[model samples]
Target: MTDLRELQFYATPEHPCSYLPRRQAKTLFVDPSAELDQCNYSLLSDLGFRRSGPHIYRPHCEGCSACISARIPVNLFRPNRGQRRVLRRNQDLEMRISEPHFSEELYQLYRRYITARHADGDMYPPSPEQFDSFLIRSNHHTRFYQLHHHERLVAVAVMDQLDQGLSAIYTFFEPEMAHRSLGQYAILRQIEITREHNHPFLYLGYWIRGCQKMAYKTNYRPIQLLINGQWVHCGD
Candidate 1:
């Protein structure tokens, strides 16, 4: 049996629940490292684990069903016309996938993304140290991609490489590019990248129904959900 103690957990201060009407939510996660390979990470992910702050987390509540693991099956994905448009619109943008790096320009874009789209949200105005703590720490094979426009940083996404596919941990983009639908663009790009790499799926952390912010995930037809310890196809 695996030693559960090897996993670490963190506590969150009491705050309003992001999911339910009156639910209090917290996360249990593991500090990720480049050493943690896809096979091991899959074990944790199957148990509802999500990475944030160098940690992989799963909902740990006495009673809760709000958080559910969701992923996109690249083999089954069929981009809708609108999704195709979003991809086409940003074709000029260049994607650079490399080891995670820190930059003032990227930080500035991150700050703008948080302030404009998530000002009151949990991840607001994180200091450079905090940012480094979150992005720089990883277990297993980890990588991040930055979207550049004319050599300017416009967006960034952090991903964990598991044996089967790529897991998208988090992403942020310039608020002024909202019309470009940067959030959706990021996911679509990940799928394309996964396909290029000949990977099977793209793990999109979690998709909480009823949350407007998360509802967009449904638009990506041909998704799969980890239900009752299995992945079931979510038809288009």
Candidate 2:
């Protein structure tokens, strides 16, 4: 077993905050040389660290604590009327789980999604290299949940299977099908999948209180937020 205390961590110099404007942000990263296995990765996740490609990191900004890690206690989650509508609207989509790999079909969808949805973000002007590095690169625990509608592939949710739960790494979908609410649907599916595997939680990454992009995470009621080094239930 890897001793948590033995792991080396380094903090990056403050950079502009991605979620909030004007404020700066700093990130604490686990040693890149450190070998990460499912055991250690899961342990790190419990401490609010998130994986970005091969690197594990957590927000360590000074004088700011807006980036809160959020997770859903799967068994305690109850979909509200809006979420139920999202599920019903996406009932036609079929989810296929597979190992991570590079494919043109997947790449094109990702490009289109990024182009249409996140063009102003850092991930704008997407490239195959960026796509490969971000999503294709993974450890043994990673899985891609591809959502299909008939013969058309609509969305992909990249996830990591951990000892106690599943972490949603990232998700991208057809921007034109915004009415289907694919992003919310993907998360609901992840919660179902977590339950199917008998996992206790579904890690939803960071939730910034005022960030519009992150507001949807709160919709998953009964979420637990990692606050002051403890996971506290944030009730609906």
Candidate 3:
């Protein structure tokens, strides 16, 4: 519904791929100060661009196209036996939608998670400043969905409400609770929330084949991959 040409985009210099080590990656991003209007942002998402804090961007590699944008058609989703267990086990979790802001509890959990799991990635050694800039919402459309257990905050999922669907931007939880598979639970809960709002798709961001970090995404069966500007069912 918005004119694509009315906005400007800048592609970043090639950097090492975060998902695929041997390959380099580039990104195309919009000028947040100039062209980050809600209309333009919505269109960018339809074109497969995702947001990290304030920057709305998508992979723009020249030779490699491993980073494929993926989404779940909520109406078509069927949780497997394992996923169903994840739901029933997490039935006691309390979910709340709130404004995007800084919280000591969330920050502590984020630090612990990154320190234990993603120390080798770009966001290694998380700090308060990095936490604020990477997870905080700048354009003002992001909503923080917090999951609590027995009144103790356990997980937080950042979601962006888009024109076509709800974008599951990022999530972090208590690293010690790894047995509960909090990451998978977060997605399932988001899907239920999407269904309640009548959203057709639940954007799951980019899924790179051969990346163990991204392998879990495939478990959400019947997902659609955006390839060559067309969406094809992964199940097909």
Off by over 4 Å in 2: none
lDDT of 1 by residue, 18-72 (tens): 6666777766556433345567677777666777755666776546776678888
Evaluation by TM-score, superior candidate among 1 and 2: 2
Per-candidate clash tally: 14, 0, 0
Q: What lDDT, from 0 to 1, does candidate 1 have? A: 0.77
Ranking by lDDT: 2, 3, 1
- Clashes counted in candidate 2 amount to 0
Lowest lDDT 10-residue stretch of candidate 2 = 132-141
Cα deviation at 36, candidate 3, in Å, is 3.0
Q: Any runs in candidate 1 off by more than 4 Å, and if so which?
A: 1-15, 30-36
Which lDDT values do the candidates have, in the order given?
0.77, 0.93, 0.87
lDDT of each residue in 71-100, candidate 2, tens digit only: 999999999999999999999999898999
**Which 10-residue window in model 1 sums to the lowest lDDT?**
28-37
In terms of TM-score, the best-performing candidate is 2
Identify the runs in model 3 with alpha carbons over 4 angstroms from their true place: none
